[model samples]
Target: MRFSREDLARVRLSAAPDPLWEVALSITKLYRPNVTEPYAEWAAWTRNVDDLRVRSAARVLGSLIPSRGYFPDFLTPADGSPSLEEGIDAVLRTPRRKLRANLGRLGRLPGWAQGLADGDPAALGSLGTAMRTYHDGMLKPHWERIRRRLEADRATTGAAMLTGGAEQVLSGLGPAVRWRDPVLEVDYPVDREVHLAGRGLLLVPSLFCHGTPVSLADDDLPPVLVYPIAPGRDWMRASAPERQLEALLGRTRSAVLRAITYGGTTSQIARRLRVSPASVSEHVGVLRGSGLLASRRQGRGVVHSLTGLGSSLVAGDDAPWPAVNSAQPEWCRPTPPPS
Candidate 1:
């Protein structure tokens, strides 16, 4: 893809994962045969889900999104709304001409889909219902894990951009993408070029986008690149180790540590734990001093993330704890009384 100076200047990462994009991409993953590690367990679980509503919803989405091929761009609108309801509303509100043009590209749609292509109201309503049902059933259960993983990715990308500019962010988007000055080359199924004529690009990190990065097939639409994230081994499973840590640290302190699985500011962490900012700050100071967490200034507030020792502790690994010292304090002792 070709990028101009304005395009480069306007480049920004999505603050959070796009729900519609994820729902569309995840549908593609669900239909794939012999899915591999990272996705294998999820695919298995989804296949075994016995809800008739979910199954019906999946069928509706599956009919639109092929396992490997072009899906309608209207399905994944680029309105940048974080709310799924708003996104779906945007989808349902797609102009008839645009819908026909996008769906027509697929060639030879089924009779039922013709109604959707012709912008029939009943068809649009059914589509919206299917999307909501599928998302609530499949994605909602794992939304927290998904949000944490994407937020962590955004944090890493943001740090790179802060340190070295947009070029650094582009260069580091994994091996599937290559940054060669003016043009960014991607490993797409079809050989295509997207020239962002000063509109810039939206970089979205997705949990369901596997292998090569995906973008809208239509160049005329808003330019977006949805890439995959490498989630931790415990990403899907509930962290039982947090409960164990509660034995070492008190309940509130343990809750604070668990809240920082991905990373957050004091205020963000406080909101997650539903505690006061002062309480979070005191707990964070202790965690930071004990060498279980690290904090760095970002703009007005500091972002805190787990240190190596803290990560192992949270994951319940058998790695030996760091020796006690003034520089590297121990966190194994009882939680200090909050000031």
Candidate 2:
């Protein structure tokens, strides 16, 4: 809660985005919606869309290593954004002494983590396997969109800091965080003050970080502040459609079209709908061929958005399509929904 002058002076901004943290936080999101209300909607979405494996892992981990209580920092080390594989490897390599100490701080090591106290290889392997499976089921599907959103936040934060100052940017972070003079007050689950010492601070933007900025369990560890970024426009507009578009495109494609407006990759869309990527890709390919959707490469995946024709179609503009003389033209061209 209070930062010394040295800590304030050493404050630094870095976007070391880590998938490991996302994995833990997302599991937390599904596990504890009552505490983190911002994630209530997301929890519903995850329940509807996340695979069974992810849900199962979340339940198990949530019961054991609570999202609110102290957990091992090595589970999610804050050293520059490590890949999921690398982070898991690090967890597997956690020193027995360090693991024991961290778990002791939390009272007892959960059954799953007890192996680490004895340096059991099976325990480490099992943990790694579960984490990897959870990542593939939950985070990987939406990582492209997540990465883009975090990158946008990074740019925005950098701009704010440049134009105003560190204090200004910190003050503007979110409602849950406050920039009091000589102290950064965060609405944590419990009372805690982190004296940053001279270690400075690492600011990590998180999508699943709902209500408050989260700091690591151990104050001795490198100081990092994980805060939430406002959801993108696509996140809020999943289910709006004109009746005419629904009839013309059928229910599934129409839904896909609406989802494309949010601009995400194939995996992201598939995950959103709880369907297979292959199925989504088939539809996306068809839509792309029909000039209803456009896509551009982003990293290893493609981000799809509505084209002019597609946008018009969804917006109830039959003007884009000339009238067909046939009695039945795409489900009678039903009356378009009110704009």
Over 1-339, each residue of candidate 1 has an lDDT whose tens digit, in order, gives: 899999999899985568888899888877666566676656666755668898878877877787777888999887464657778999999999998998887777766778998899999999999999999888887675677678779889999999999999999998899999999999988889889999999999998888889998889888999888887444566555645788888978877886787788988777554479999999999988999999999998899999999888877532322222222112111122121
- For every model in order, what is the number of clashing pairs? 0, 0
Q: Against the true structure, whose lDDT is highest?
A: 1
How much lDDT does each candidate structure score?
Answer: 0.80, 0.68
- In candidate 2, the residue pairs with backbone N, CA or C atoms under 3 Å apart (3 or more residues apart, or in different chains) clash, namely none
Q: What is the lDDT of candidate 2?
A: 0.68
Give TM per candidate: 0.75, 0.64
**What lDDT is obtained when candidate 1 is compared to the true structure?**
0.80
Q: What digit string (tens of lDDT, one per residue) describes model 2 on residues 158-200?
A: 8887888777877998888889987888888788878776787
TM value for model 2: 0.64
Work out how many backbone clashes candidate 1 has: 0
